[model samples]
Target: MSLHADAWSTLASWRPDYYTQEALRQAFLGYLAARPDACQRSCAAGHITASALVFDAGGEHLLLTLHPRVGKWVQLGGHCEPSDSTLAGAALREATEESGIADLRIDPVPVHVDVHPITCSLGVPTRHFDVRFAVRAPRGAHPVRSAESLDLRWWPVDALPDEDGELDMMLAVLR
Candidate 1:
């Protein structure tokens, strides 16, 4: 199946909260319909990004990265590469690459969807229609910071920084 078809299927299966159900579904369907290159970075109108909210084996803590450019602690994710077959695969690949933990297991279902504007170093401001999934890290896993992040740390799920909206989104999905 095409990546776009996979994204459509994934979104169709997601059961988002009442607050986001209609908006998320509409945003995803619109993305698929309006942009043929929705999976690629060049889609200036907006593009689909995949992210993983990673928790430890026992679910006590969440792994977050301080994004260098964005200057905020956020979930592990990035642009969808051509090699990724599904949004879940893109999220898992991003988590593995950003956290340096190879044994992460990602739930195939999307837990949340968000549309937010961002301006990368290369282009004009664009929106990231992010499909987020939950990932459980290996027991006793140790994560090393990648070049994409300024720092990497495991924050207790209950003690996450309140300033980061991404944390709130994660908490909502995990609950």
Candidate 2:
């Protein structure tokens, strides 16, 4: 199946843990149905981006990147590429590429979905329909910074550099 079709299928059957998440899932599916190019960056309006929130093996800390574009500490994720076969693959790929950590494992099911506007590399204002998934890094894994981030490190979940409601919501639902 195509990436777009795969995303549709994934969301179509997805069972969000919260009411708000369920709403986002429904809205995202509607958006995809209306915009066939929603999975590609060339859409010129908005596109689906995949991300992973990487938690330590013991779940004590989560890895975050100081994103150069957003200038804030956030999860590791980015725009979907043509090489990615599914949204989950895109999230895992971004996490691996940005974290530079080996033996990372990603949960196929999404943890959250967010829609935010930004002036992307396309040089135009657009919305990023971000799909977030939970990932776990190997014990004693070390991360190397990538060009996409100004800094990358593991932060205690209770003392994050920035407030991430999405993470909180996911944690509440998962735990």
List the candidates' TM-scores in order.
0.95, 0.95
Each candidate: what lDDT? 0.87, 0.90
Deviation from truth (RMSD, Å), model 1: 1.3
For residue 19, model 1's alpha carbon misses the true position, in angstroms, by 2.9
Candidate 1, residues 69-88, lDDT tens digits: the string is 78888889999988888999
The CA lDDT at 10 in model 1 is: 84
Runs of candidate 1 with Cα error greater than 4 angstroms are none
Q: Candidate 2: worst 10 consecutive residues by lDDT? A: 162-171
| Consecutive 10-residue window with the lowest summed lDDT within model 1 | 13-22
Q: What does candidate 2's lDDT look like per residue over 38-94, in tens digits? A: 999988889999999999999899999998888888989999999988999999999
lDDT measured at residue 55 in model 1 versus the true structure, 0 to 100: 94
lDDT for model 1 comes to 0.87
